[model samples]
Target: MSTELLTYLFVGVTFTLYIGIAIWSRAGSTSEYYVAGKGIHPIANGMATGADWMSAASFISMAGIISFVGRDGAVYLMGWTGGYVLLAMCLAPYLRKFGKFTVPDFVGERYYSQIARVVAVICVIFISFTYVAGQMRGVGIVFSRYLEVDIVSGVLIGMGIVFFYAVLGGMKGITYTQVAQYCVMIFAFMVPAIYISMLITGNPIPQLGFGSEVTGTGMSVLEKLDGLSAELGFAQYTDGSKSTIDVFFITMALMVGTAGLPHVIVRFFTTPTVRDARKSAGFALLFIAILYTTAPAVASFARINLLNTVSEASYKELPKWFSNWENSGLIAWVDKNEDGKIQYTAGKSFAGKPSFTDERGESGERLINNAPTEGVNELYVDRDIMVLANPEIAGLPGWVIALIAAGGLAAALSTAAGLLLVISTSVSHDLLKQNLAPNISDKQELLAARIAAGAAIVIAGLFGIYPPGFVAQVVAFAFGLAAASFFPAILMGIFYKRMNREGAVSGMIAGLAFTFAYIVYFKFVNPADNNPEHWWFGVSPEGIGTLGMIINFSVSFVICHLTAPPPQHIQDLVEEIRVPSSNNAAAPVEGGQTANA
Candidate 1:
């Protein structure tokens, strides 16, 4: 069958599987809708969390970023995984023990105020919506490229899938579906990476293969990569050219932001016990590492493959994938020097320089059709295409390509569903049911939840269509918001007895406002592109989340010292959340009655 037909078949089968799963598991009560009835296995929950956590950025853009950034890119690998460590060690157990339906319950009760709960709800909505928009965009991009559909159509299709299961199954449906998604995404990511590694270096482990000697080349992989990069004026693959302080702060920001995210924290609530929460966290990291470790290898291999292919080729002779991507505008090439050879020079110059010399030519700077590009030039291949394009770049079979398409969509859609669930539950359970209309029936509340979820999906899709520049940048802001606003309040509520309502509410506002203002000022108002020399203390807007988080902790602590102590009842609530008893885990809030009769 043709590639086009095969793509349709693959997408069709994947959609059927998702629909089948949704039908098999329909959430009945609020408990099932919220936390999978608190009966999920540790391994299963871990898989689900992995699928939920690994967004399009992780599946599609991660390796490509690593490929271009080299050692400097290790920040993502370390920052992302390290956050899980913090989660497993410091946060997950207590939150799981709290046993609440939503994170706002903990904030409200622990801080002894409904106002704190509202703040928590706002934070959750902000973080989840911003992150979900990226996932929707990712889904659309993958669909447009592989399925030959427009991004708008792709987004609508994704919206339909997310709407069905997220509304029907809630967390219960998402948990199981994500488990299956994890398997598909991971296997699809690793297979092509391993094959390409073997083809290039005679090694199976892509991580080690990145540093090992290249086949038929006496030089080590890093050495070869470094040499190739140098020839093109790019940074060495193994060198650290970035300012150490900036990288440190950026990595730290990402780690703390990961730990602070409400959706990620709520995953722990689905487990049966504190022990399960801990174990699930470890398992989630292990599953995540399977891809994280291999991602670097894929990036390195693809970088080399891309350069070799496009370096000397003419436009007409380019492969189908190249032409297809170019037409989509995700990839662009400009022959600046007009030497008829595409150049891969690394300097600040936007002009094209010859990337690879044509072995067939003697004196002319003319690029050869033998390679991927026609003339000496610079090509802009989007970082997001690395994972999806890997199989095609390596000359894999059509099935593998099809599998990749499904896998990319799976990764994007799974995360989108999870985030949307969080947004809906926050509105329905926390805001509407708890505060607005406490007497609403469960059926009516669920209907409200469905409406909330559907609305969030449309807004998220629109944002994706007009995405802000830099996928990771927006993601970092999402994380920063979580860390600054949610992490401090939640952590203090659990670990500090002195944390009072006033302190918690004030602290959340401080954190949220500070983080938002800093990002807006640097990202939009003054803007980095327009004012390159005006960064605050040399910190990029991406790293401001860390600063915002510190400000939150400081304000929370200072306010707690000056304010009255928490009421005796709130102290007991803290103790309850910390304890490992079944009763404590039964209801997330002490007075909030169960929605189910």
Candidate 2:
């Protein structure tokens, strides 16, 4: 079959499966809608979390980021995977034991303040939507490029698939589907990576392949990459150009932000026991590592292969994928010397590198520009296209191409469902039913949850169509917001009994406002626009999220110390949430015996 037909077949089949799962497992009650009736198995929750965590960015964009950024890209691999360790160890079990449907519930009940819940809701919406927009955009790109659909229509289709299950099955239905998505996405990501690795380095393990010797060449892949990079004036492959302090802070911020994300935290609530939650987190990371470990290898291999193909070649003779990507505006090529050959060379470093001169001896730009180049030089490759372009880059079969398309959609949709579920429950269960109508019936709450989830999907879909920026950068924003506003509040509430509602609320506002302002100023206001001088404190907008988070923690703690202690009842509530007794382990509701010992 033609690649187009195969793409349609695979995508159609996957959609059918998701729809079928939704129909068969339709939610019947508020419990089912919100927490999958709080009956999800630990392993199942782990799988779902894996799917939810590995958005289109993870599956498609991560390797691309690594491809272009070189050494600094390790921060993502370290920060993202390392954060899971923190979640598994410090956050997941305790939160699951708290047994709330949403992250804000813990914040509100633990702080003994409804105001804290409101602040949490705001943070959740901001972080989740920011994250969701990237997923949607990823889906759109996959569809537009592979299946030949319009970008907007692709986003709508992805949104519709998520809406079906997210509204029909709620958390319960979405959970099982996400498990399936995890399987499909993982398989799709690893197969091409493994093949490419073996082809390039004669190594089977993608992670090790990164450092392994290139086939028929005695040099290690990293060494070769470093040599190639230096030839073009770029830094060595494994050594970073950014300061160590900046990289340290960026990694720390990502770790804290990952731990604080509402949708991820809420996954633990479905596990049956505290131990289960911990085990589930471990399982989730294990599954996630399958791709995370392989991603760097994919990036390295693709970079080498592209350079090998394009270097010293005429522009019109470029590979089909090159033109395809160039047409998409993700990859650009310029013939600086009019040599009919694309020359990629490292330009002079601004600090002290040699300045260039034209034929007339007038000073010229530091670099010759093009996608494929001759010596050490500057070359621009869009990181977002790395994964999607991998199958073709490696000359994989057409079926693999179609499978990747479906897999990318699966990754995006699974995360979208998870985020929409949290958005729905936060609104319907926590805000409307809890605050708006205490007497609301379970049936009415279920309907409300569905409506809220559907509405959230629509809003998220729109943002995907008109994405504010790159997938990884947008996702980093979500992480920063989560780290700043939610992480500190939750930690203080659980670990420090002296923490008051006023302190938590103040901290959240400070974190959220500061992070948002910083992003706007650096990313949009004054704008970096590819200029290095625009960064503040050597922190790009992506790294600034960490600064926002630190500011949040500092402000929250300072405010808490200045405030009076919580009232007796609130103190009792805090104590109750800490205890893991089975009787109190049931979902939180008014008039229930406090879980406090």
Q: Pick the candidate with the highest TM-score.
A: 1
Quote each prediction's TM-score.
Answer: 0.92, 0.90
Lowest summed lDDT across 10 adjacent residues in model 1 is found at: 357-366
Reference-based lDDT, each prediction: 0.79, 0.79
Put down candidate 2 lDDT per residue, 1-597, tens digits, no spaces. Answer: 987799899889988988888888788988777777767787888899999988887887778878877888888778888887888788777777766778988888777777888888888889899999999999888887787676898899888888888899888888889888898898888888888888899888889888899998799988888888777666777877777767877787788888998888888877766767777898898899888888888889988887677677776666666665544445555445667676665552211112433332312223334122343333345568788888887788889888888888899899888888899899988888778887999999999989999899999989999998878878878888887888888877767778888888998899899888878776777664534465667776666778877787788778888989877766655565566554434534334643221
Can you tell me which runs of candidate 1 are displaced by over 4 Å? 347-377, 528-532, 580-597
Give the per-residue lDDT digits (tens) of candidate 1, residues 1-597. Answer: 977788889888878888778778878878888888988899999999999888887888778778888888888778888887887788888887766778887787677677888999999988887788778878888888888777788888898888888888888888988988898899888888888899889998888897788899898777878888877777788887657776877788888889888788879889877778888988998999899888888888988887777775675466777656654446656555656555666643222323333333211122334333433336666677877887787788888888889899999889889889889989999999989999999888888888898899888888777776555556777887887888788778888878888878888898889878877887678664534256666776667777778888888888888988987866876776666655333533455542110
Give the backbone clash total of model 1. Answer: 23
Positional deviation of residue 581's Cα in model 1 after best superposition, in angstroms? 5.2
- Estimate the lDDT of model 1: 0.79
